[model samples]
Target: MIAGEFYKWTDKKGTVHFTDNYLSIPHEYRHQIKIQKMEETSEKKMEGIAAELLIKKSVNEERKAISDGEKAFNEKCTKCHSLSGKNQDDSATQLVGLLYSDKFKESTLPVSEDSVKRIIKEGGGEDMPSFPEMTDKELNELMRYLIPYLKKK
Candidate 1:
């Protein structure tokens, strides 16, 4: 891909919206990006506010999902891919945290029990390993545990 300038506009709420295609932005914000280069401080302030708001939103939504994912990870994945002091860098344990991120919520990255199970039992990536012995039922249980986080976004 070639590197190029991206047009970004700050909303009234200070959210920094970005787009490569001009049609992605609303008319209200279209002028903001065009005018923003005139002042840099305001841009920084807007980005900071946007970041703060993003963090706050993420922290607020996982009250129950986080608890459930942790419980499931502790109960199941912990059996082998331990999250103990000795296995601090464990792969399975580490994956639990991102099992249901909004980043993977779409069809492009569907986070379901079956999806996780397939990866677990048929692991193939550079850092992945197969848990071929695991049954479909077990995978479903794991997905059940992670359902909350999957639904978060």
Candidate 2:
């Protein structure tokens, strides 16, 4: 129709009813029903839809980042590093309890995001080679994946 409208009414039991069709109102309450413009309702609906879409987008992006981070770790660091404290090689370092490790706890440097990022980008002695080629996005995603496993301070 040219203009949209809303019909609202309250029943004898104080239950409120709302509808867009005028004919849906009961015969007895038809004359007492209040008429409202659809503009406010449409705006509210649009806002709700927008918020829901935004939340879904954020969740999808987070899942993708986690997946990418796991892939990156498998490709780049899994050879010499072990997650879940299961070392394939005795020489490899266990990365599961990074903050809780004797090396990190004993060292003057705290186990922090900056320190971890630096170690990944730079080298942690001859055993660990620097990955200067790793992009910032890949590093960030990898860090996110590792954050949960890292022992909190």
Candidate 3:
């Protein structure tokens, strides 16, 4: 019997791919297109779903990394640095007070903001510990916080 209202074909290799116009092919070739198109459609759908899942996972990972950085700064830098409008009761604040003294003002050392950041990164005297782990941005922020108190009269 004819395959259907629309005939199709196959090859000796057993591939069943189809075209709507298959009338010129031999009878033996008709079986090749007989199986179904739904299987291929399902495979493509699965591939699309996998790609979407991977994209979502990458975005989530980036957000998580930023969250972890913020948390770490709060736990570490916060122990010493105070936010704006806050009291200066912390050890780091007290240290900054000394830097603002007339003696510091009189010192020949450079008074620029980058210089202040270097002091924080490398430590001034034996009383201060090295902050090798702090990023350049964090060091700059810490220096900015202290600069107000250390301004020249």
Best-fitting candidate, scored by TM-score:
2
Over the stretch 1-153, how does candidate 3's per-residue lDDT look in tens digits? 334233335567764334334554566665555533434456675456456547756776656655564565466656655444334443444434544555456788676677666776787766566677788756655544445555522
Candidates in order, TM-scores: namely: 0.33, 0.65, 0.35
Candidate 1 lDDT: 0.56
Q: Which stretches of candidate 3 lie over 4 Å from their true place?
A: 1-100
Across 1-153, the per-residue lDDT of candidate 1 in tens digits comes to 123344667888886665445765788777666533324536676576457647656665545545554675676455555423243234434443454543345447455566766777888456566768766655555565565543442
| Greater-lDDT candidate between 2 and 3 | 2
| Clash pairs (backbone) in predicted model 1 | none
lDDT over C-alpha atoms for residue 83 of model 1: 29
User: What's model 1's lDDT at 73?
Assistant: 65
Q: What TM-score does prediction 2 earn?
A: 0.65
Per-residue accuracy of model 2 over 1-153 as CA lDDT, tens digit each: 126665668899997766555665689999887776667567876465456547756887898998899999999888877676554224347777677777777788877887988889987867789999888998899988887776632
The worst-scoring run of ten residues by lDDT in candidate 3 lies at 1-10
Alpha carbon lDDT at 110, candidate 1: 57
